[model samples]
Target chain A: MSTKTETRKEEIIRIAAKLFKQKGYSAVTMRDLAKTMGIKAASLYNHIESKQAILQDVILTIAEEFTLGMASIQNQKASSTEQLKALIQLHVRIACHNPDGLAALNSDWMHLEDKLEYYLQLRNDYEANFRHIIERGIENKEIKNVDIEVILFSMLSTLRTLYLWIPKKDRLSEDELSASLTKILIEGINT
Target chain B: MSTKTETRKEEIIRIAAKLFKQKGYSAVTMRDLAKTMGIKAASLYNHIESKQAILQDVILTIAEEFTLGMASIQNQKASSTEQLKALIQLHVRIACHNPDGLAALNSDWMHLEDKLEYYLQLRNDYEANFRHIIERGIENKEIKNVDIEVILFSMLSTLRTLYLWIPKKDRLSEDELSASLTKILIEGINT
Candidate 1:
């Protein structure tokens, strides 16, 4: 694609993410996206192939970014505690950057027709890698001997929903948010 | 309403909750709901007024249940730690009983046209009560002096998303699930 074409495509994806986050994937139509963009629906088609294409672009890009972040963290020499902190920071930063896209990535990935399996694979792999880090934490005595699945589930639940919370909390810097989350999540609040 | 009418209305609501959870409130039409229930769309109107009515029923009912649960817990003489555990169990049990309704409550409450503001008030009140409990814990030194918002956010995020995880682990009883969550959430996992 030409530079202008690519820029327009990105703009379309951004607006579509906002709509998908608001009305959900199945409810958002190409015309709705075009209306939001102040472009004619026919003009939208000139830039993007289909509504599904917009969703695929919005979700896969964020999913891949997460996968890559996890991979990079996995290769580091940090302890599991540090590794988990890095993971939390990754989620917070990404969520702060594009909460609308993250919302689509969370709620609309199932709507990916041709790319459903690919998205699921990335999600499963990302989760598996997260669980591995927790398991290693237990083995290294960095974390308690709790049920691995419970710890994983609790942590993942909070991390996955960061996008919903980040937009409401615009005052906290990324580092401040990450540190607060790390302190609460990694270390229990019990005195 | 007569007992028979009430029963049929509830049945319609139950079936509608399932459809809403699967396809979301916006995507599931009255026809789709009626088809799922093996009834004519007109008959669906006999039981429930509209798709918005079904969503309002599903979400408002669950939200009210949480509100009531929190109210009862608030009157307890228990410590903050004990009260928080009760809150967790409340969420787990409610999610277990009506995972589909809970899913609708979480995701599709935005579609609760007439009841939207009421729902938002209930949600905000519920969070305020939760934060009050956490603040009490910090004051009593039951919980560490972490960011109250962070603790509240982390705990609520996990508790709110329990419906998404409960179905996959049917073997763990509600008590077991609640206990595991309490351990990881209230106590730090660090050794």
Candidate 2:
């Protein structure tokens, strides 16, 4: 979503996500958010209830998007390799558009307070779905005879850290990254 | 090195690394260290000069290990694939034996004050050497025709996060983990 089209609350959540990325969720305050926006704390409070509210919005929105993306891929009638590519694209899309939010999701998701369990549930379900796809692929001989957790861990680590790499690497466009990553990740680097 | 052979200062550094992983390097106090060690703060000081000393030992020790690992790999007359597998094994060995130290190396290396520049120089050289090896592989038509940075980033990401995953994954032995990771990371997951 672009800044011009965002609602007041959406604007606050977006900016707060950046702040949470810069200063951890626990360290950020209402005044900090307000100062970043060039507004008074009272005005900031008008749109968001508290720092916790913004964190939930910042993290949960992206988490739900990932969950929904997984579901959408399942709805497609595609092979396991195609599904995996789609999954990579989903991450690339989110990471490209919402890098700051991705940072907060990685760094400050622990500070979700009462919502931690639900966030973890979403994450667990997401990984479960990812694992099931890989498992099915292995059973069907689409994937190689490899350890499932190793495959999952290796892929997830790279995808999770894409936020860190995406900024410093300005030459590679999102599509280039998606293609190169898919090739390097899905197709072995072996000649 | 095992606990039996470690000196008192080495024990403090090892325990401090665990503390740094649990509570970040900046948050841990000398008092907390003494309490955890079941000794007085004055006694703790007899072994280490300050928190900075412990932090430096915890992080730089691992950093230097990685640098030295890379150097040892260069001394071998091996192909790029062999070198890469050795690198993966190197990460697995360090992670399995010193998981806490790896965490400190990953998370607390930024707080290394005067030594930070040297630390970064070591990391940059390590990565440059890694990149050069892959580049040589590509030029020799041994490695797949893939983007060097993408391959580098993907492999480094997984190898770097071994500390977080090692403790939870008790079923896989060190050699098994190293072999599976070597295969999955180098050969890709495709059938």
Using TM-score as the measure, the top candidate is 2
Error of 1 at A139 (Å): 2.4
Per-residue lDDT, model 1, residue A74, is 97
Docking class of 2: high
**All models, RMSD in angstroms:** 4.0, 1.3
Q: For every candidate, give the share of true A-B contacts it also has.
A: 0.86, 0.80
Q: TM-score for all predictions?
A: 0.86, 0.97
In the order shown, the candidates' DockQ scores are 0.70, 0.84
Which pairs of residues collide in model 1? A188-B188, A189-B144
Docking class of 1: medium
Clashing pairs in 2: none
